[model samples]
Target chain A: LEKEIAAKDQRAHEQQKFYPDLSGEIAGAVSKRSEPNLDRDFDTLDEPVWVTVKRDLNTVGAKFGLVLFPTQGNQSLLRNWDLWGPLFICVFISLLLHSSEGKMGPHFTEVFTLTFFGACIVTLNIKLLGGTISFFQSLCVLGYCLLPPGAAAVLCKVLTFASEQSSLLFVIRLLVTSVGFVWATYASMAFLAGAQPPRRKALAIYPIFLFYFVISWMIISHSH
Target chain B: MTDLEFQSFHNQVVTNVQPIRDDDGGTTYEFQHSGDIDRVKLLDSENGTNSTPQGNKNLWSFEYYQQFFDVDTDQVMGRLLNSMVPRLKTNFIAQHIHPIPDLYGPFWICVTLIFTTGICGNLAKYIETAGSTINGHFESDFHLVTGAASAIFSYVTLVPFGLYSLLWYRKSEVQYTYLEILSAYGYSLTVFVPVSILWVIQLESVRWALIVVAVCMSGFVLAFSFWPAVRGDKKLIAFGTIVGILGLHAILAIGFKEFFFDAALQSNKFGADNADFSSGALDKALTDPAPNAALTLNDSQSKNAKGAEPKAASNKADDKESSKATANGAPVATADGGGQKDAAKV
Candidate 1:
């Protein structure tokens, strides 16, 4: 009877120790469930490929939206750098800039080299100026910010295809391209301007200005 | 490979105080120590930022190309300023860019010139036609960017390549690597950037004067810089190279004037009038050098009538119309008049 009583007591002690451990595990799991970063890592093998692609596409679209409507409150683009948006924007712009019938525009390779290399050089310039941004982050911001000019290029291409070449059309193109140039420069500066040293802001901004200026020039001049 | 070969030849001719053939292998031991020290110093001086030994690296490595771009802003600015002063005695390759030829000045200078030429060319066109009756609506012609790129790139690349080959073929007294010559040629084009911007003033006299000044400044730099490279060659060869260099320089300036700035303006003004005229007659009319009555007619008619076959196809009707338009005024054909003579011929 004493042995029986002692065994019960020992079992009670083990159960008490396990109770605290179980409670701690429950608390840990609750905290992990509430963590915001849980969705960032997903098992690709557990889900369908389409799900992965769809989620990736959603992320890219959200990035594009951020670039399009850049506000001071949202700057997640530089924090999580991705090349998908940049690649798409670059290829689309290059494809649009390629020479079409009767109009002599920049070749595809020319546009590609200009965009990729131009971004690389500009990023290098920023780094040389002691910018706080990472190389890819600056690149992502620059590439994504090209959306405005890309939109302008699209509008110009449509205008060229829709109507005859006239001074009025040209004026419209100039206005559209100027807007795109200004918006692109401003947006990129908004994202990347802080990365540069305060005193050398102008130096960093100048290259960005020239970079977009060249692209804007291509847009305004090429479609006609 | 060519760099290695040229380096060997260059070392044999210029840096070798002792003419010992390695086949004998007797003085090779003596050459090794000095050569190593010289190489270390050269590598150090080439890029103080990254003093990686470049001698053993393959050409395909990124580090090989980095050496060519190892210039600071101050160095580039100094090199750019030095390129503008066209003195006969300044050996650009020897003094400015010696063993280490930087590509930063050449690359950026060429790019700057390309944009300047493209933008300024359009500006000149706009200024020329600003006062016309064509509504003066400004449209940026993007073709100029492509055209300027081709012209300037071909000129910079091909000219240096040709000169390098010529020098290599002749086995010239001073061995100049292709990059050194390319660097010299590229920097010499820096004077054109501002000159191109100044071309927006639509005055022929001013244009000509600008071209002369630019060509002289840039041409003298090229001629004087290259003279030493070819000096040890035959007299005819050396003078011929200099003359060729100057001629090409002048041609490029004139080409910029004629092709980009002048030709388009004339074509826009006289395109309709010259539609039906014979090719020779059109040429004659273009060269008439007269401030004729077609100015007022073109102003009114070409406003919306560009490529209007109904108007251009009927030459007789156009002539009567031109005569009526000219009789109304003192013929304010004060500038760039070409269509009236062509219309009269048709």
Candidate 2:
């Protein structure tokens, strides 16, 4: 009778163990039966589909207009039809007009080329003054006027200087070196401006000045 | 030159001897002098014909040698002249320096800044003529030359700013107050911006296109120029520039809200009586020009400001936007309604 009682007690303890009452056989269908989680999907997207979304879209459009368009990286259906597409077209036109401004003149390309020549003529006068102007210097000024402004300007300038047919490579190099030194000197000044360059040690330049030029050229050429 | 040396020299003469005097009495004797000074002190060679073999050193300093021989003096003078003047026809000719392609990089940048600034500085004077202005063809050419050189000066001044930004070498241990410097630099930019914009806008036909392009490009360029401040957290920079641009647009909008947003805002309403948008209509269109007007109601509001003053007598005080812009960075601007503005930027 005592042994019977002990067995019944052990059975009772086993019954109390943490286990779901699954009398049915295990199956893959059980795993697939759960409800789809909507919480995460709701969190990541434009939240209030009413006013917030409309306002967001409008403001986003405005902001996009102000920005330089993530000129690359994202693909679009109207890759050649949108603002950037026309931008590409304009840039192409600018490049042609710019490259031949000297060979051609203001009346040909008109506005852009004329502005260019006017600027160039002035640059030459400056050179005559013996401020150590060079071919690259001329090209940089021309490039500045010709290029469609912003990052494109700097990219073209770097590429022109890096060319074997570089006009003022020595002067450019000196300028670049001066820039580097100036950066160092004014790194102090720049620091408060929140320009604490990471790894600002000497190693930073192997990447910042040199590597960036190479990378930028690669990216820009590939883009072209 | 000594008597003894002179005697031995004749004994061993190394020249094709000629008579001391020719037909009328001029002779040229070519001789290669060959002897140590010690030997000369012991002998005399110039007087080989009649001098005794005297070892007197003073014999070398005889006055007759100066009178008899023809020493060349023009060689040194010719060399001096050659050294002073450059060989203008050769590669030694003046260096030909042309400006770079665009207003980019330090090389041409230093050159261009001066160029743009001068033209801008003089543009008011130029356009005011409403006619061709000049000195002479060459003088005009020289003027053009000088006019262009001014851009270089601006360029020179401007590029150092760029180069200074890129330099790696820094000085001293004192921490740089970059924010202060940036604010100062901001002032410099303000000085340049209006000038550039005014110069571009003054040209006809291109004004609208320039306006659109300016709206499009200036904000982007400003951000690009100030990118260093963005560091890794670009969102802040993006936000600030966007806000700054919006604020600028807002300022422009408050003055001419209707004209800026839609073409119909300023469309002509034709009639037999010809009732269309006029200057009064322009002021009426500005719903929020009161604050702007009140701001201009200052001690010395310029002549241009009075043209755009709102009708509401106390309108200026209520709207603080335009007044605020004047109080902030740039010079006081009047309502620019399709006319040439005398503003600038660099």
Candidate 3:
């Protein structure tokens, strides 16, 4: 019995020595890196073939928007999606507008010319810039929705039952959604909202933005 | 410059520099030491009149990063990211990161080189058309600030350093994407937009605020980028990415529509050609005139000296107790300021 006890003690001692403590005494070393981290490590270091798999899985999870509370678990890129999504949406809106402008050629050439030229003037006057906005986010979002205009709801259902019902059909559906949103915003602005003189409209918007900025600045200044 | 100054100055630059801090603590900037040092004389004597930089923006030193860090493992992708990260310093910013003072004098030199090219290149033409006149007075001094921001570094500084940083990034835990960096570059430009206005407005209050804000935003990215965990830290980054993307969209959508209007503002004041020029050209034009403006002012002063009664008359006046001297000789300086209009002569 004593011999068996001694053997167990030896094993414990070696395990304890896995790491050193402040006093250089042997300390317990925890094994098991919580599987996700393990997967992440593999994903980052794995060969190209496996990388694609990891990337797709990650993107798919991102596509769902967010199932796992991004904050609680890992520091994955998806957590910031709330704010990111809006930025992406803005880009999409711009592209939609650009394409619509493209469609109105031949007869509406003058209108198109006026619209584009007017935009450039407004950009510089009020210090309109490119950094606070970009095209990448919108592209990514569109991809998530399975290309633009379809809003193809090819819901990437991990669950077998959901996949059986709508995955294939949704692929096309996303495209439709994009088309619908584009038309809605453009048609509303063009046909519904009567055309205001470009310069005057710009002048109007600048003040409005300035007013908002000033008020916010004031409120913030006063609060502090 | 001494290491102390380099360190203190670095505190200023990192807040304003690119590739911000790798982790939150602070950024590691590399200062590449070039042999050339501006021999500045502190004293004002016959021999003390050594060369200080002609303008405040002249570079005192320059250096580039020794290396950029990136993931180097060839292991399977999963194992590499997951496994390699464990070995990273809990302080994931490179352990041997260079301090700013070490980087700055070198950085300033590099910046100076870049600014020179940028100032001299096509950009200068455009800035001149922006109207040398604002409220009837041309701002000859504006280039003292904006010109510095736009310069393209000397080839020596721009090339090897550029390659070094790229190589460094390739070797680090996270390989930076050109697109990602470029977008960040764009955002940096936007954040910095307000600070550049300091030259235009010259308000200590507004300028300081913008400078502080610009510095904060500028360093936030690269400094944060150093850690895989931070880069991997999806929460803030993803949110930021999303916001940034959305912002891009909003800006482009609005910007395209807004561009024409902005350009139109220059018409009556600047003329048609000014709008056609790239912003770089405009910036250069503004700076190019500045050097000449100073020279003409000096020339005009010499003429005034000749036109004024000879020094003998002033001496005679002093001798007769009729000498008149003001508290300052500022009239001569005003002549210099006025000489901006004479810049067309250049």
Candidate 4:
């Protein structure tokens, strides 16, 4: 009878363990309610939904946050697509602002379209390489990842205001755009890694590398 | 049911229900289930242990600032006295004490205090400028308020995010959360409160002293918070982070000086004083009606006789002699007279 009682007590303890902690569940429920107007089926794994205004706002904030703090931003982005779309918009705006101040301002539409085409190509490459990410997700990641280059463009524009093109300015522009290009490439590659097959991930990264190289080249040449 | 089954069943029922005898002559049941717990209770339980003392729930609410004073009195006092030293211990204390992230409370408090102090500082500087000049108008109150608000917004948002990114990029092994870093940065603003008040003193030396103290306090806190976490890595990264933090502190100090302390107004006051001195002396020498009495008479004569070239020539000779006399006393007096002559000719 003593052994049986002990066994029974142990079994009860294990059963209690299976029961979710009451406090944690309550907290989760509160946070869930606090989340901005998400649909009831937001947690459904198989379905992709259109982005809502609240989600887009959150994403924009996240993207801005990431630009300021990449490590935390990266982790947050990996966990959820909170900031990617906004980051892309931010970079695009910055690029447009910079290009508008230059002699080649009339060609901005062409430049924009070309950049968009490059993003599409990179997305296509990822798809062809057996990457499982959605087209929009790839586009979002690639667009937002262009932040460094966009920042470089702004710097170049500011420098151009001081002088049209000096050797020092050229050197600075080269260094900045180069760093931005490399950063964008690395960030996009890392973001897309999970979607691409492990063995061919490196091969998948080549199009991204080419895409950023063209962007850097465009930024540098126009800056000069 | 068996004895054990009945006991389990009874426990479940007791845990799930609360009986209440209603004054309306009806029996009303209140559920005592865990799922029905209030937000405060949920926060408390999520923090893992409820044994720690809790302040009023309303303390953290922005609407109830008075309660902030009541509840966060200890933290406020601690920040004012020891600043970053005491704040750095909050992470450790949080593990045992109020499990709810206490960072938000202090963060909001710091932000509010910084902006309030900044606006006051700007007002004081405006008053000083107003008192110093006759026609000097105070800057628009709207401008001051907007400047302070925008500055606080950026400091709270962009600056911390930038620093967090830099730290994360440089020190991947560091264990601190982004929020913890932000909290430390926010708490560091306690030093700025005193600095902002000191700006009202209207002394450059006092402003400089405040800047130094603010920078030292903030830099020390940032280094102290990050050092332990990053020390295990290559010393270069730690050194770099400390240097970056110090640089950020310096930038913030300069920004405060520019925005809150009215450095531009101070320069403008000096310019106005110098202008008054030079122009006052010039006014005495050149535009004094008594000293220009002869010229005034000669000008009227010349005006009456339009073809009187001789009188005009005589007036010019008289003017030259009088200007020489004035020049003997003050060389700048001649330049002022010459400028007036040119203006009269035009």
Candidate 5:
């Protein structure tokens, strides 16, 4: 009986090696039967593109979840880095923050390229400051860290709808964006702080400060 | 013996072949060595850039952008010098930055200009406001950095893109890539880097002089460099394009001076105008010149509040007072609107 059970576990492990269940094997055999076979031989070349995109999005979403609570193991973001989250967050923020009739805000493309260029500059600063992290990894971490600011932008948008432009509203925007700036900086530092030498950590952190500061300023200055 | 050897060769060929059953229960004869090699090659071709194929690089990959930043220090310095001294014969983009334009120069030049403009504009403001009682306390406005970034970045990118599109539309003799146009525009702004630093000198005449010098230096470089691209088009349109280019360049320099360095004077004018509107002086002036019959009802109400005087004089003072309430209320609303505009400007 024990031998039979061991054989069943072996088969399950081998099957898992072939087919990855990103949602987890939580539902036992029911969900296993429902998952489409994405892991096939390359010679076939017949898998629909959406299946791969769905899988990648799942991974990206998981990383976004990790960014929310940047604890000790959040460094796993560097292990398998991707830019989709950043791109999505940037587009989200830019779209929300774009200029309209009376609301003079940053244009769409300005905010979009600003994200890429800002990421590039911040990554270069990290490399120059002697951080051991790879280029794209720094970009990935910085991009994912934009989640807080993106959220702040959304919150400010909602806040704008509720009231007229006044000092009180400005104060609220300041408070909200400051929280976002601090959160973004803290989360990114949590993920990246270990990569720098002890002496050069502050040097590496200053650009990150400016990067988030500029973003937060944009968020706060978002007026109607 | 020949018959026996031929029969043996046929038998050997049959014996070496084997039928293998695939997952779909189809049996196929395979030459094992060649099949493995073909399968590996098929996978390689299918995987594409994962195996490092040269010339066809994935555009979104990091290595693709590395080429733009491959420029050395000497190349950047050469491009900087080339941008400042406009040589009519030399096509700067084609002659200097070719094969691949270095983005490092443009990116860093814009960055340097943002900081210099922001810091110098603040310094200019400090000097202007040092003795003023109105704005006694001075806090450095960091919004200038954000404003400068957006303005400088959008100008650098959008202007070149528009020009490239226009050239493409005209079917010009020269085919300039967007990046090449962008590089030219970026280098053109290099003159402003030093000029912006000089704007801190607090002399309006000197500031305007720097603006003229910087605009002419960079504008000529832009005009001369871009002339070849526009040369083949119709004569009027071509000249118009160059004029438009210089006009836009002049606008940017003048805007930087007015908006950033000369902000105090403009704001002071707005404040004085707002004050005059609120204080009923403008209202008195308006009511004195034209006393419309509709205002007399409002006039009598104010006359009762201020005690007796001559009927016409009372009517006029009352007109001023009543108009003052309405006019003052209007300016306050406008003041709110103006404040919002100022915030938007920031």
Candidate 6:
């Protein structure tokens, strides 16, 4: 009976160790500094919702850091639709760059429609292929994967201005963009590899290849 | 006895062969299992904890700005000085070690230099053009203050935002936060200060050379600072980022050349109007020997010179006739008096 009690205590201690006292200890220390009656305030104080939200955002930020560095932790952030933050940011950026030429409304609409349709097509392909990944996960991977092409688009705008005076610049722009295109293709392939069944992997890659090809074509054609 | 012995020997042989096959299969299975285990371990190591504790300090918060500014201005100055040299320490301080409060200091400093030098360069050109003109007067359609302000504003807002957007797209592979990228870009502008000042030099080749060097230096610093963080198969992305950065800087430099220190403006001093004025003066000097002869020439003489030869001759004839009429008026009056006297005598 005593041995069982000891084992129970040990189990409780182990569980407690795993979850460090996140709130209480920090709050206790802070409250101790400012107020003498720490216990009463500590009991009454409720963490703000914004604080939790901010913390989650920070976690996302950290995940972004991991993505940049590319660690195992990046995989968790990879499969969630919430990770499409960078994609939206890129879209906004492209809009800003495109606005320079005036008549940005059409361009903005086109980009949005294309990206949406592209995501839908990819999602549909994944669904039809008997892949294990969810629709949102596919969308998430596709969205983040579009970043390189989006960036290439922005660079192409700069290149358009540059290419006018120098043919060398045009060639440089082409090379740089092609590099981005290849990278995007490779990155998407690596990232989306899990979403497709083993037998149909090549089939799943076709859409990604098509998507990037269209983007590269647009960038290259416009640059000329 | 013979049948039993034969069956026992066959069973022994079968057992021996089965053990060999089993051993081979077991080794292969174990090898694959170990590989899988290693892969899992690698993934686990890579995936370490994703949740990083976020501080309550918001980038847009006043407290954050306050803290950023609260630091010694000298520290920023030191950073500006250090930014001139592209190295690990400067990068570490800018990116990792110190939390630069805001990009305000570096940004403003760059803006100030850009505007100051831009205005100065424009003014210098204006003064030079004025000095070269016949009337010593030059009017610029480009307003100095307005032009400088607009250019600075565009540089501050557009270029940084463009870069920020690029970084945002690469956020997964770029470890730098928006603030860090902005700060790095802002610090990178320090090279431009000297470049801007050098722009005032009249030598085109020297100016171009200096600009190229400055741009390279600035690009190198920025690329070096961000290079270490880029890893894995994303080296191509990193190269693209660096190239994009250099391209943006080059565009700005080109813009500075085109608008601010415009060679066209310099060349325009010898425009058609100036050519006409100079040629008119030359014609006057060649036609009239005296220095002020062109000024002394009356309107009629100059007009006659410009008019037809027959018109001038006609004008001279009309002048002689008017003089002759005055001269004959006295005789005509006497003749009339004599005729009136004769009539009285009769």
Each candidate's B-chain TM-score, in sequence, is 0.63, 0.23, 0.24, 0.51, 0.66, 0.54
Range of the 10 consecutive residues with the lowest summed lDDT in candidate 6 chain B: B285-294
Report how far residue A19 has shifted in candidate 5, in Å: 24
Error of 2 at B266 (Å): 26
lDDT by residue (tens digit), candidate 5, B203-230 = 8789878976787688878877777888
TM-score to true structure, per model: 0.60, 0.19, 0.21, 0.35, 0.48, 0.36
Off by over 4 Å in 5: A1-120, A124-133, A136-224, B1-34, B37-55, B133-135, B272-346
Number of the candidate with higher DockQ, 1 or 5: 1
Candidate 3 interface RMSD to the true structure: 24.0
Clashes per candidate, residues 3 or more apart or on different chains:
1, 72, 100, 2, 0, 6
Better of 3 and 4 by lDDT: 4
Determine which window of 10 residues in candidate 4 chain B has minimal summed lDDT: B18-27
User: Which residue pairs of candidate 6 clash?
Assistant: A68-B172, A68-B173, A72-B46, A72-B47, A73-B47, B68-B101
The alpha-carbon lDDT assigned to residue B311 of candidate 4 equals 36
Q: Rank candidates, TM-score, best first.
A: 1, 5, 6, 4, 3, 2
Every prediction: chain A TM-score: 0.79, 0.20, 0.22, 0.64, 0.76, 0.63
For each candidate, the DockQ is: 0.08, 0.00, 0.01, 0.01, 0.04, 0.02
Model 6: per-residue Cα lDDT over B1-346, one tens digit each? 9879655443433323333434555544544544565577668866554322234466665444434333333455666776667554346334432565455445455545654564456555755665566544333322333445555555455444554555555555545565566666667677777677677767678776876677666666765665554433264555544444454455455446544665335346545443233223222222222122122222332342343233323433344334433333332233224322322232
Candidate 4, which segments miss by more than 4 Å at Cα?
A: A1-224, B1-72, B84-101, B136-140, B170-173, B263-346
Better of 1 and 4 by lDDT: 1
DockQ of structure 3: 0.01
lDDT value for model 1:
0.68
Predicted structure 2, TM vs. truth? 0.19
Docking class of 6: incorrect
Name the candidate that leads on DockQ: 1
CA RMSD of each candidate after superposition: 18.8, 37.5, 27.9, 28.2, 18.0, 32.7
Candidate 2 lDDT score at position A50: 77
Candidate 2, residues B1-346, lDDT tens digits: the string is 6878665554333121213212223212322333333357445555553454342234355332221111112422232232223232321001110111112122232233333433343333234322333321110001222433443343234322432332212222222233222322222222233434354334433533434334333333332333343323334333332233223333332322122222121222221211123223334333233344333122122222344454423333323323433432231133222111211111
CA RMSD (A), model 4: 28.2
